[model samples]
Target: MTKPVGMEVAVAAAEAVALCNIDVAACYPITPNTHIAEHLADIIADGRIDAEYITVESEHSALSAVMGASGTGARTFTATSSQGLMYMHEILPITPAMRLPVVMGLGNRAVSGPINIWNDHSDIIMQRDSGWLSIFADNGQEAVDMFIQAFKIAEHPDVLLPINVNMDGFQLTHVVEPIVFPTQAQVNKFLPPYKPFASLHPDHPLSMGTLGLPEIYTEAVKARDVATVNAKKVIVQIWQEWEKQFGRKYEPVMTYKTAGAEILILTMGSMGETAEVAVDALRKKGVKVGLLKLKLWRPFPFDEIRKAVRGAKTLVVTDRALSYGGPGGPVCSEIRAALYDQPNRPEIVNYIIGLGGRDVRVEDFMKMIEGAPKAKKSGDAYQIYGVRE
Candidate 1:
């Protein structure tokens, strides 16, 4: 017997935290991301859940606190965005290297330069090599579901890595849409209290987070790298389990109506929704085009991407962040790299779209398709979309 549920990212977020029954929540407020933390606090205050709510002074401290708390064998949670995420960059490495399965919600926002508060992938992209299992959500429902999935995958003994569930700042964070929030009993049955395999203790505490010799340092780093690289398979497995229990399906990379398409468009995070509009319009006009939405970014599904993009005539990758001198876009570079080794790989084009929360109309995407033919003639890896001199 399923009960009725509503949207509101804040409420959905609160329900996720409550369902996980997190033992520790160390946080500092930031726009868009603040509501998630606020709602969790309210839920805790009302005696809805018994969890340690640590009001930290800064994002760095917030992550550091979670690093320590999760080290002590407690399931932990936190939320942040943009500058807040940037502030915790230093501690991001520490959380994963120490093998804490802390789940965080990154309400994706544009990193500031001239002072802006819109959404972008810069913040998460900056932490690209930070060794965390990064997952991007296309909507509010994935945002809620991925967090629950993060805990299970991250805490797994085979993949002890921190995970970030990324959602667009104002877009998904503020927008209201119906999301199926799991009951406490279901959540309990799904994700139990995190029992850490390794920890800092006195009786068995040999030495935690100690500096390793140069000979051992590289191996230690590779272990984490291999774990992240292998995480794609684990991610798919976990999603299947999640679907089995909850009756909702998700894949590390989702292909929309691409079974027999000639050209495929790739997108990540929130832009995938906007791309869906373009896909529909193109399909209506008898264009053999489709979409590929990338959900797992950190432990990138390279093999999956290569297989998916095969047989397509042209592949257009729409990125939200620029890589500068590489393909001019982060997602484009990764996709290109993934297909570079394939003999039958399609001609790929990269387009940077929707920066600083810009409105991405379906026509803009149509323009990208119009420009794709010339991209091969020009022989450049990418072209900035919707940019004017």
Candidate 2:
């Protein structure tokens, strides 16, 4: 399978982390993730890819030089977006409580004020609790297969978090598709090299970002929320072994025909491809509707979004970014808290739509799925969509 046509899903995400043999990149550039660190510093200056790029300056020293070259184990990676991910919001909780499986590429932007660039997700939605394993890609072949399955579920020794691979601004990083660049012998028989169960050893040296009080700081933040809820079962067993070596099955939450739908839209990056042509033109004008697509926003799948809006009667969602006064934004307040304990739950409708890079076309998701029956019975928490005076 070969198909790297006109490239630039940020150089097919630095050629899929140099075919997953990454060994320290530590970058510093933010755009659309600065053309994926300028095409991985020209594939580490044409040595063909041995790694060790490290051109740091600021996104907090490019995540403090990939948390000090992934704490001397080194299989790191980097890329940023929007105010350089809020200027690395204080080492994004010290690279997953110093676990350091640092694989990033969050080119989704739109987090300025009164001054704008493009796309949105409020810069990885303010690092949603900074444990970082946020994924969200809706194009460019799921942002080069979620940066190679977010470094095999963030260096999975039972998930050592710190994986963020969003894609949006300039729509999937200067949008050019037909990806499939997998074979470096199938990404070296599916990503191997990183073997640091625990690192930084000048002969057994440790002591990283310490200072835990309050009786071991609530068991070190409950072992980083049980390693981010055991990364939802180790990201479904590394996405079922990356769908048996890249057949692709990415469903940390994705649905299309919402079962027996009576309308369900919801969305994520690239407006879920303009809500998949507004769910096939409102299902060829018959309009039963269905969509949902949120490829993992933090550890918030919420049981596959409560079984894809459980027999929907109206779902909607659709936020781009806006939580200022706070009503509906961060993925429609996590899809209204995953259907607020659904007992026949449906009637949800947020809709803030395509800010800054605003042009959510396809007839603005087919006039918001043909007004989803009066904006889901108008119990509004939102409904902004291409706002004006």
How many clashes show up in model 2?
0
lDDT of 2 by residue, 150-212 (tens): 888888888887888888878778878777777888777777767788788889988777888
Please give, for residues 116-161, the per-residue lDDT of candidate 1 as tens digits: 7888888899888888899988988888888899999999888888
Output the worst ten-in-a-row residue range by lDDT, candidate 2.
1-10
Candidate 1: segments with Cα more than 4 A from true spot: 1-4
| RMSD of each predicted structure | 1.4, 17.8
Scored by lDDT, the top model is 1
Q: List the residue pairs that clash in candidate 1.
A: none
Would you estimate the TM-scores of all the predictions?
0.97, 0.36
Best by TM-score: 1
**Total clashes, candidate 1?**
0
TM for candidate 1 is 0.97
